[model samples]
Target: MANLLVTGAAGFIGTNFVRYWLEHYPEDRLVGLDALTYAGCRRNMDALRHYQQFQFIHGDIGHYENICQILREQQIDTLVHFAAESHVDRSIHGPDTFIQTNILGTHSLLKAAKTVWLDEQPGLIHRFHHVSTDEVYGSLGPEDPPFSETTPYAPNSPYSASKAASDHLVRAYHHTYGLSTTVSNCSNNYGPYQFPEKLIPLMLVNILNNKPLPVYGDGLNVRDWLYVEDHVRGIEKILSAGIVGEVYNIGGNNEWKNIDIVHLLCQEMDRAFAERSELAARYPLAPPANGQPSTSLITYVRDRLGHDRRYAINANKMAYWLNFNPDIAFASGLRKTIAWYLDNESWWRELLARAAP
Candidate 1:
C-alpha cells in the first residue's frame, strides 16, 4: 500500500479529497494531519472513523520538527498539501496568519519533504503536489482571456499574495533542489462539507434561516465554479500522471456571475422545498411553509475590499495533457450540492456555532 500524507485534511477541499482517496483507492494508506483550526473540524472526517487504512494527526505544518517527524515515521511517499489560511475576508482583516500559514508553513513543509524524499534514489515515484487557487492571477477585464498556466502572477489580496508566494516556493524547490513537485491552480470550488463562510454555503445557510443573502457589490464577480469532487478527481489524476515541475490548471469551465449562482440556488431551493411539502404526510420534517420562495432574502452588501473583478481558468492543459475533465456540469452539480446542504444542516450548523463571534 502506498503511504500518502494529506495536510489540512479537515478543511473543505482537504476533507473532500481525503474521502475521495479513501473510497476510491482502498489499497492506499492515508495519514491526514490537520490543526483543527476554526475552519477545520474533526467532524468533517467522521465517515472515515471506521476505515483501517486511514489515520488522523492533529498538528500544525508550521512546526518543522513535527512535520519532519510525521513524514519520516509515516514513510510518506506522496505529499498532497492542502493546508492554508484561505478566506479572503479573514485575510483582509488579519494578513499575518495568512503569511504565517500559507507562506512560511509551506516553506517548512517543503524543507521537510526535500530532506526526507531527496535521500532516496535520484528518480522515484515520490511527489509533492501543491493545491492553489486561480486568484493568484489577479483580476481580468471583461474582454480579457481566461487565466492559463503561463499567466503572470498579480495577486491582489493577502490571501492570494500568500498563496502566490507558496507557489513560487514550490517552483523554486523543483528548479533549485530538483525536488519532484507539481502544482495545480484551481478555480472556486463548492460542494458538501464546505465551511459556511464561503459564498455558496453561506448563502445556503442564510436562506435557510431567512437571513439576508448578502451579495457583495452588484454580485457581478465572475468565477469558474468547480464541484469539490471534480476538483479532487482532477488532483488525483495529476498526482498520478502529471510531469514533475509542471503546473496544471483545474477548472469546471462553468463560468457564471455571482448573481446568477445565487438566483439558481433560489430556484433550486424553491423546487426542492415544494417537492418536500408534497411528501409532508410521510416526512414529518417537511412543512407547507418550506415551499415558500426565498429569493427575496438577497441583499446587496458593500463589495469586499480588493475583490477580483473576474476569474476564469483555461483548463485545456489539464484536459489535453492529463485527459482530465470535470464530470459534473454546473446545473447538475448545483442541484446535488443544494440537496446535500439541505440534508446535512447538522454539519454546517455546528461549524456556525463554533465560528469566532
Candidate 2:
C-alpha cells in the first residue's frame, strides 16, 4: 500500500481525488493537507472524516519546513501536488499571490521531497505527480491542432505563466536532480464541489438566483472541458504506469464554445424545472419558476484581460501509452453537476455567503 500526501485536498479537484483514492485504496494510508483558502473549503472534506485511514492537516504548501516534516512523519512515498492559485481573473488582478503560491510554493514542495525522499533515504520507492493546466500552451486558432505533450509553452495570463514556471521546475527536478516526477497538463475541468467562481458553477448559481449570466467577450472562446472524475482517473493511470520523466495531456475531447455552454446549461435548467415541481419552490427567484427561459439572464460582459481565445488538449499520449480515456459524456456530466448543486444547496449557499463582501 502506498502512503500518500495530497496537497489542496480541500479544493474542488483535490476533494474529488481524495474521495476517489480513499474509496478505491482502502488499505493505503493517506494524509490530506490544505491551507483552507477561500476556494479550499474545509466543509468539502467533512464526509471523509469517517475513514480510519485518512488524516487531514490544515496547513499551507508555501512553508518548506512544514512540508519536510510532513513528508518525514507520514513516510509518504507518493506525493500528489495540487495546491496552487488557479483563478485566471483573480490572478490578473493580484499576481503576487499567484507567483508566491504557484512558483515558490511548488519549489518548496520539491525541495522537501528531495530532502526527505532523495538525500535522506535514497532509492526509497516514490513518485511526485504535479497537476497543471493547458493554458500554458497559449491560445489556439480555429484550425490549429490541439496541444500535445510536446506543445511549446506560451502562457498568456499570470496564472498560466506561474503554472508554466512550476511545470518547468518539475521537469528540471526530474532531469537534473533525478527526482521521480511526472506532469499532466489538463484542459478545463467542471464537476461537483467546484467553486462558484468557475464558469459552469457560476452560471448555475446565477441561473438559480435569477441573476445575470455574465459571458466574457463574444462568449465564443473555446475550451476542452474534462469532467473532474475523468481527470482524476487519468492521474491515477499516470501514477500506476506512466514514465517518471514524461509529460501527459489529459482532455475530455469535448470542445464547447463559452456561449454555447451557457445556452446548453440554460436549456438543462429549464428541463429540470419542468420535470421537477420541487425545484420551482426551492429556487423561486430563478427564471424557470416564473415561466421564463434561463437564457433570459444571458448578459455579455467585457472579456478578461490576456484571455486566450481557445485551448484544446490532444490526449493521444495518455490513450496510446496509458490506455486511458474519459468515459463521461458532456451532457451526462453537466446534468450530474447541476443535480449536485440543487441537492446540496446548503454547501454552495454557505460558500456564496462567505464570498460576499
Candidate 3:
C-alpha cells in the first residue's frame, strides 16, 4: 500500500480529496496536514475518523523541519500540495499571508520533499503533485480561448500571483532538481463541504436566511465550474497515468455567468422549499418560507478589485493523455450541492458560528 501526504487536507477541496482517497484506496495509508487556518476547518474532516489508515496533523506548511520529519517518519511516497490562501477578496485585503503561505510555504514543502524523498532516499519512488488554479492565466476576453498548458502566466491578483510563483517553483524542482512532479491547474470547484464564503455556498446560505444575495458588478463575469468529485477523479487519473514533469488542466467545460448562477441557485432553493413542506419550518427566514421568490434577495454590489472577467480551462491534455474528463453536469451537481447544505444544517451552522468573529 502506498503512503501519501496531503497538505491543506482540512480545506474544501483538500477535505473532499482526502475523503475520496481514503474511500477508494482504503489500503493506502494517508497523512493529512493542515495549518487549520480560518478556511481550513478540522471538523470538516471529522468523518475521516472511520478510516484507520488516515491521520490528520495540525501544522503549518511553512515549517520545513516539521514537514521533513513527517516525510521521514510517514515514509510518504506521494505528496499532494493543496495549501494556499485562495479567497480573492481576502488576498487583496491581506496579500502578505498569500505570499507567505502560497509562495514561501510551497517552497518549504518542496524543500522538505527534496530532502526526504530525493536526498535521503535517492531512489525512492515518489511523486509530488502540485494543485493549482486557472487564475494564473489572468483575465480572458469574451472571445478568448480557454487556458491551456501552454498558456502564459499573467496573474492579476495577489492570490493568483502567489500561486503563479508556487507553480514556477514546482516546475523548477522538477526540471532543475529532477524531482518527479506533476501539476494540475483546475477550474472553479463547487460541491458539498464547501465553506460558505464562496459564491455558490454564500448564495445558498443567504437565500436560506433571507439575507441579501450580493451580486458583484453587473454579475456577468464568467468561470468554468468543476464538480468536486470529478476533480478528484481527474487528479487520480493524473497520479495514475500522467507523465512526470508535465502539467494538465482539469475543467468541467461548464461555463456560466455569475448572475446566471445566482439566479439558478435562487430558483433551485425556491423549488426545494416548495417541494419539501418541512423546509418551510426549518428555514423560516427564507423567502420561499414566506411564499415569496428567493430571487427577491438578489442585490447588485460594487465589483471586486482586479476581478478576472473570465476564466476557462482547456482540458484536452488531460483527456488525450489520461483519458479523464469531468463527469457531473452543472445542473446535477448544483442539485446535489443544494441538497447537501439543506440536509447538513448543523454542519454549516456550526461552521458559520465558529467562523464568526
Candidate 4:
C-alpha cells in the first residue's frame, strides 16, 4: 500500500480528490495537510472521519519545517500537491497571499520532498503530482486553438502567475535535482462542495435566493469546464502511470461562454422548481416562456482585472497515454451541481460567512 500525502486536501478540488482516492485506492493510507484558510474548510472532510486509513493535519504548507515533519512522519512516498491560492479575483486584491501560498508553499513542499526522498531513501520510488490550471497559458482568441503542453507560459492574473512560477519550480526540481515530478494543467472545474465564490455555485446560490446574479462584463469570456470528479480521476492517472518530468493537460473539451453558462443554469433551476415541490415553494417562478424569466436576475458587472478572453485545453496526451476521458457533459454536470448546492445550503452558508469581511 502506498503512503500518500495530499496537501490542501480540504479545499475544493482537494476535497474531491481525497474522496476519489479513498474510493479508488482502499488499501492505500492517506494523510491530508491543509491550512484551513478562507477557502479551506474542515466541514468538507467531516464525513471522512470514519475512514481507518486517512488522517488529517491542519497546518500551513508554507512552513518548511512543518512540511518536512509531515513528509517524514507520514513516510510519504507519494504526494499530490493541490494547495494553492487559486481564485483570480482574490489574488488580484491581495497578491501577497498568493505569492506566499502558491509559490512559497509549493517550494516548501518540494524542498521537504527532495530531502526525504532523495537524501533519506535514494532507491525508493516516489512521485510528486502538481495540480495546476490552464490560465497560465493566458488568453485565446476566437480563432486560437486549444492550449497544449507545448504552450508557453503567459499567466494573466496574480493567481495564475504564482501557479506558473510554482510549475516552473516543479519542472526545475525535476530537471536539476532529478525529483520524480509530473504536472497537470487543467481547465475550469465545477462540481459539488465547491465554494459559492466560483461561477456555477455562485450563480446557483444567487438564483435560489432570488438575488441579482452578477455576470462579469458581457459574460462572453469562454472557459473549458471539467467536472471536478473527472479532473480528480485525471490526477489519479498521473499519479498511477504518468511519465516523469512530463506535463499533462486535463480538460473537458466542453467550452462555453460565461453568459451561456449563466443562461443554462437559469434554465436548469427553472426546470428544477417546476419538478420539485419544495423548490417551487422556495423559489416560485414561472418557466422561461414567461417574460419574467429567472434570467432577468442576471446583472452585468465590470469585468475582472486581467480576465482572459478564452481558455481551452488539448488533453490528447492524457487520452493517448493514460486513456483518460472526461465523461460529464456540461448540462448534466451543471444539473448535478445545482442539485448539490440546493440540498446543502448550510455548508455554503458557513463558508460565505467565513469569507465575508
Candidate 5:
C-alpha cells in the first residue's frame, strides 16, 4: 500500500503512468498533482475518475511550500517527478517558463523531498524517480551509437538545457544528500492523449483537416520513437526494481527520420480513412487527392532553432538490468495511435479549440 505521488499527472506521459499504476496496482494509493497548465488537461485523466485508489491535487511543483504540504498530507513514499515545460518549440519561443518550471520547479521539489524524507527514519523504503529526455545529449551523428546512461550531457535547445539542469539537480541531491533517487532519460514518445502541438498528433490532426502538415528542415531530423505505454512500463519497472542513484535510458530501438515517420503516418491515415469511407459515404469529407492520398499534405517548414540532427537511445541497460523491452513496434503503435485519435476526435478537438487564439 505504498503512497505514490506523481507530478505532471495530467500531461501525456504522466497521465498514462497514473492510469497504468492505477490499473496494475489496485491496492496502492496514487496521488496526482498538476497545475492544469495549457498542456496539462484534466480530460486526459477523466477515465480514472471512478478509481478509488487515485486522488488528484491541483498545484505547482515550483511552489516549495505547496509541494511540502502535499508530500506531508499525502504521506508520499515514492515520488515520480514529471512536471516540466517539455515542448522544444514552446521553449524556443519563451525560455523563461522552461527555466522556471524545469529548473526552479525541480529544485523546489527536491528541497521539499529532502526536508521530509531525510529527516525521517534512515531505512525508509522511499524512492524519487525523475523522468527526463535524451535531448539532453544533444544531436548525434548519423553513424554514432545511440545515447546510453553514460553519455555526456550536451543539451542544445532551451528545453533540453532546462531538463539537463533538472537532471543535474537530481544527481546532486543523490550525491550530496544521500537521497534515494533514480532517473530515466527516454527518447521521443508518441501515443494516445498526446497534445496536438507535438509532431505525431499535430501532423495527424492537420492531415485529418486537409491542412498542410508542417515538416521541419526537410524533415531529416531522426529520433528513436517509443510508444507511451512502453515508456510507462519502463518507468514502472525502474521505479520498482531500479537501484537508487542510478540512471536508465528507455527507447523503442525503432529509430526513424522525421520525413519517414510522416510518410508512414500519412499512409496509415489514408488506409484508415479509406476504411472509414467504406463504412460511410461522407467519411473523411475530402477524397484522396488524385492518386496521392493524404501524403500530399506534407509541407516543409523552417527548421527549429538549434534542432538536433538525430537522437537514438541505447536501451541495453534497461533491457538486461531491468528486464524492460517495449512490446509495441513502430508501425503497430502508430496504427493504434492514429485509430485512437480518429476515435477520440472530441477529446483533441476540444483541446485544439482551446488552443486557438
Candidate 6:
C-alpha cells in the first residue's frame, strides 16, 4: 500500500477521488492537501476526517518547503495532482493564478518529488500522476475526429494554455530527469459535489429556484461528458496499470450539445420538482415546454471569448492499454446528478452563500 499525497483534495474531483480511494483500498494511507481556495471547499472532504488512513493538510502545493516537508514526513510514494484554476471564464479575466498554480505550482511539486522520492531513495518506484483536461487540444470542427493521445496541442484559452504548459513540464521531467510520471487528459466531468457554477449543477440549481438559465452563444457547443465516479475509476486504473512516461486520454464517449443538455435538464428538473412540490400540486405531469417550464428559463447570452467549439476524446488507447470503459450513460448520469443536487440543498446553498457578492 502506497502513501499518497493528493493535491487539491478538497476540490470537486479530488474529494471524490479521496473517498473512492479510501473505500476501495482500506490499507493505503492518503494525505490530502488543499489551500481551500474559493473553488476548494473543506466540507467536500468532511467525511474523510473520520478515516484513520486519510489525513487532510491545510497547505498549498506551490510552496516548495511545505511540499518537500510533507513528502519527506509522509513518505509519499505517489503524487496525484488535481489542483488548478480550472474555470475558462475565470482564466479569461485573471490568468495570473492559473500560471502561478498550474505551471509554477506543478514545478514546485515536481521538484519536491524529485528531492524526497528520487534523491533520497534512488531505486524506489515513484509516480507523479497529473490529472489534466482535454481542453488543451483546443476546438474541433463538426466532422473532426475525437482527440487522441498523440494529438498535437492546440490550446485556445488561458486555462487550457496553462494546462498545456503544465503537461509539457510533466513530460519534460519524465524525459530529461527520468521522474516516473503519467498524465491523463480527461473530458468534461459532472456529478455530485460539483460547484454550482458549472453547467450541470448551475442549471439544476437555477431551474429549482426559477431563475434564468444562461446559455452561452447558441449553446451548440459540444463536449464529451464523463460521470465523476467513472472518472475516479479511470484515475485509479491509470495509477495502477498505466505505463510510465505515457499520456492517456480518458473520454466518456458521451457527447451532447450544450443546448440539448440544458433542455433535457429542464425536463428532468420539472419531473423532480413535481415530486417535491405539495403547494404547486403539479408533480407527475410535466408542464408544457412552452409554458413556464424549466426550458422556458433558457436565456441566450454572448458566447465566451475564445470558447472552443467542440471537445471529444479518443480513448481507444486507454481502452487497449488499460481496458478502461465508462459505464454510466449520460441519461442515467444526468438523472442521478439532478437527484444529488436536489437532496443536497444545504450543501449548494452554503457554497453559494460563501461565493455571493
lDDT of 1 by residue, 216-249 (tens): 9999999999999999999998988899999999
Residue runs of model 3 more than 4 Å from their true location after superposition: none
Q: Rate the local accuracy (lDDT) of all candidates.
A: 0.90, 0.95, 0.94, 0.90, 0.90, 0.90
Task: Candidate 5: list runs displaced more than 4 Å.
Answer: 120-122, 278-292
Among the numbered candidates, top lDDT falls to 2
Which one wins by lDDT: 3 or 4? 3
Q: Judge candidate 5 at residue 77 and give its lDDT.
A: 89
lDDT of 2 at 110: 96
For residues 194-313, could you state the per-residue lDDT of candidate 6 as single tens digits? Answer: 988899998887766667889999999999999999999999999999999999999999999999999999888777665566413422233432246778779999999988999999
Which window of 10 residues has the lowest lDDT sum in candidate 3?
38-47
lDDT of 4: 0.90
Q: What is the lDDT of residue 139 in candidate 3?
A: 93
lDDT of 3 by residue, 1-357 (tens): 899999999999999999999989989999999988877888867778988999999999999999999999998999998899999999999999999999999999999999998898999999999999999999999999999999999999999999999999999999998899999999999999888999999999998888999999999999999999999999999899989999999999999999999999999999999889999999999999999999999999999998899999999999887888888989999999999999999888878888898
In model 6, the Cα lDDT at residue 111 comes to 90
Candidate 2: pairs in clash: none
Residues 226-326, model 4: lDDT tens digits: 99999999988888889999999999999999999999898888787767767655454333323356898999999998889999999999999999999
lDDT of 2 at 114: 95
TM per candidate: 0.95, 0.99, 0.99, 0.97, 0.96, 0.96
Regions of model 1 farther than 4 Å from truth: 119-124, 278-291
Worst 10 residues of 6 by lDDT: 282-291
lDDT of 2 by residue, 218-245 (tens): 9999999999999999999999999999
TM-score of 3: 0.99
Report the lDDT tens digits of candidate 5 across residue range 66-153: 8888888888889999999999999999999999999999999999999888875456778999999999999899999989999999
Clash total of candidate 6: 1
